[model samples]
Target: MATAHTHVTKQQAPPHRAAELSAFGVLILLAGAFLPIMDFFITNVALPSIDTSLHASAASLQLVIAGYGVAYAALLVLGGRLGDSYGRRRLFLIALVGFVLASLACGLAPGVGVLIAARIVQGATAALLVPQVLATFHHALEGERKARALGLYGATSGIAAVVGQLVGGLLVGADIAGTSWRPIFLVNVPIGLVVLLVAARIVPGTRSEHPVGVDVPGTVLFAATLVTLLVPLTEGHSLGWPWWTWVLLALAVILGAVTYGVEKRAERRGEVPLLPPSLLRLPSMSRGLVMVLAFSIGFGAFMFVFALTVQDGLHADALHGGLAILPMALLFFAGSVVAPRLLSRFGRAAMSAGAVLQLAGLAWLVAVLLADWPHVYLWAMAAPMALAGAGQSVLFAGLFRSVLADVPAHLGGIGSGALITLQQSGLALGVATLGTVYIGLAPHGASHAFAAVEYVHMGIVALLAVGVAALPRFTRATPVTPVTES
Candidate 1:
């Protein structure tokens, strides 16, 4: 249920906009929230340049991306829980400040070592800032206003996925002020500084009266599990399949098992486990999370593979490659905008439809690849790309609501964090497994190699469609998780 009118007036609603504050305050809050997601995609296009300029290896480059994602997924829950315990506004400001400092450190990094360190620290601070976005909106808005806020937030994510490419390509290709790839990191400075100042004035502070204490042990254990699991997945290929890679992978599994035991013990003792056991108990929530992991892995690997196929295999320049993805980008925005409406009507059926469409598109795409491996062009690929893009956008909105629908307010942060962690682990795995397979299969020409890679991905995407179809039938737009007193 939406909050009482009295609570909304007291807690979050600003009197007016211009005439009063209105929901514009919440809008400003979302702008600050969007930066980190944008940063993730933006960095991918810039990675080749970063590698060449800084003498970073393929392994180190993967680390730059993986390290941020690992830290982000691991600590995101803690960041959200802190907002619940302390205050959302206070943490937002502090996290914003940390993000700025970290951005500056990344921009100024002289060597590969410094850049990687800054990226990890930057990811950590982003964990703190982003959780506050959804929590703040939840605390502050109600009814139609709340739905609009969340829909818009998800839309921003959709837009960022596209904009990251445009911005990364333009800036990196500009070689602006002769900064080369450095401009990509440097550009965040102005944007971050401005958002910080504006947010201080507009966003409201809100926290639940009753909140769980931070689970310190759970945080450490979870972080360790993610780092151990993700590090080798991202770096192992470069190390020539070392024995340590297998060792670390096994250890990550063990650490994750131990972490669950610790959380179970804490729950038994009537303490807030790092992740509340009840979270996993919700069958829909469980399925939604698995969907998040599967979806993100396939999504992450698809983008990475496409970039290599276009640029390295086809000999397209950065600008040309970025422009080629524009059709998908445009339809993605369109799909996200229309999805909230579909959710209100068709419900989880919308998700099923999205999956079927994506599978059709991927299957069509595979046919084109196998038949015209040496002669494919952007024009030939546009149809499947656009359909897949729209289908994917719809899929994410459905997934987001499904994951959080039954989440208790106290543990919303953890639930969201856990979803992201599973998402990232899946993403890292996709890149490692799918990427390794594609690279291994394409032992000859760049064109044939790229063709083989897409064929594999089409099959993977088809598998993901089956999983999405399996999502609990009730997850139409949003399945209501029964609020429990536990």
Candidate 2:
């Protein structure tokens, strides 16, 4: 009996230890994922403070935001490839340290030029870290555990957007140490340090079993494509639609075509491309990427518009603006917590249901906006906001899962990078497009402009509902091929 008992204990030990480690590692990776996204939105609330403090020109201020986004989006695929070629753990740590140093530089910069430069560096480092989070989860976890982790990842993403605004407002409002907006960037220092120490101990070093070499030409072309495309959209309006903006837009189209052709040729030559065309050819990947783009566009647009409505239109302070959306943030978390269970029971249908719910919530909110107009109270918007948040949470997780469902494990890093790159691009596009619409119409009437935006959001969500509903119920996995490193 004693021998039998000892044998059982020995047999159980490894699995138990692994489970604990997996959970802790996920927490660390999620922390890494959270900071980059949070930093993106956190600065939104602090922008006014920054402008006042630095006496920044409008163009430089726009650069402060656009620069970070463009850098992050452009280099994401390269970051993923590096993690795959070298090691995810190594790259994650290196990127985390870079992110921390960049954050510090942003916080302490003596002038706006230095701040913009640091922000771009901060975004570039974030690209290096964030993709590893998803790739590691894909490579390491499986089945139910994978589902739950993905759900949590979706939750972390949604929550970070809201928390960024909330924390930024609070920090600016409190004026910690009389530093005003600086605390928003500086706070990342301690949190990042703690995560770094813990991650070193727990996060397993994982990389692609068949690593792909970095494709330099493809990388440069892709980066150029995104920079030309995103820069004009983000800055065109503020710069009063300069002739150069149109020229860059035209260049972006040509560059994008060239990049695709280069990547395809590389694949044909039996070289690993930065983004493999064959990977995008997978039905699950292509279709799910579209959904991700649409969802992100709506989300980004709504968040940007709502913040302006509360702060500029309603004349609320930063803290109050953040507070108005607290219900949405809380419910979003709750929905994410419940999403894995729903997916287990309902399969792909769960995503459709989530979209439907989101549409309903949007419709409700739009009605309230139309009815109350300028007189709308914060509490009046709470119910619909919460409903929409929960729906978005479910849809986000489901979409994330679907996108990678057919991707082979060996390609997880590049696949994850593609997923996030589209997501970030959608966000920037959303802000540029719908945000422009809102801003243009605001002078006519803030309430009317907001209502118009919400109507567009409903249309987007309604289409999303149809798209998710039409997705194939099952995904066939892509087969992996062994490649000898050249």
Name the regions of candidate 2 deviating beyond 4 angstroms.
1-22, 55-63, 137-151, 475-486
| Highest-lDDT candidate | 2
lDDT of 2 by residue, 1-486 (tens): 233123222322221112233787888889988999898788777766787899885456556766787788778877877886787778989999999999999999889999999999998999888877766776667776775676567778778987888888888888878897899899999999999999888887776654556789987998888788877876777679999999999999999999999988877766667777888888877898898899988887788778777766777777776777788888888887887678767867888889888888878887887788777788898998888988988888788767877766545545666787788877767766777777778779877888888888888888887888655564422211111110
Count: clashes, candidate 1: 8
Error of 1 at 230 (Å): 1.6
Would you list the clashing residue pairs of candidate 1? 16-20, 16-21, 16-22, 17-20, 17-21, 347-476, 347-477, 348-476
Off by over 4 Å in 1: 1-21, 366-376, 405-414, 438-443, 448-456, 475-486
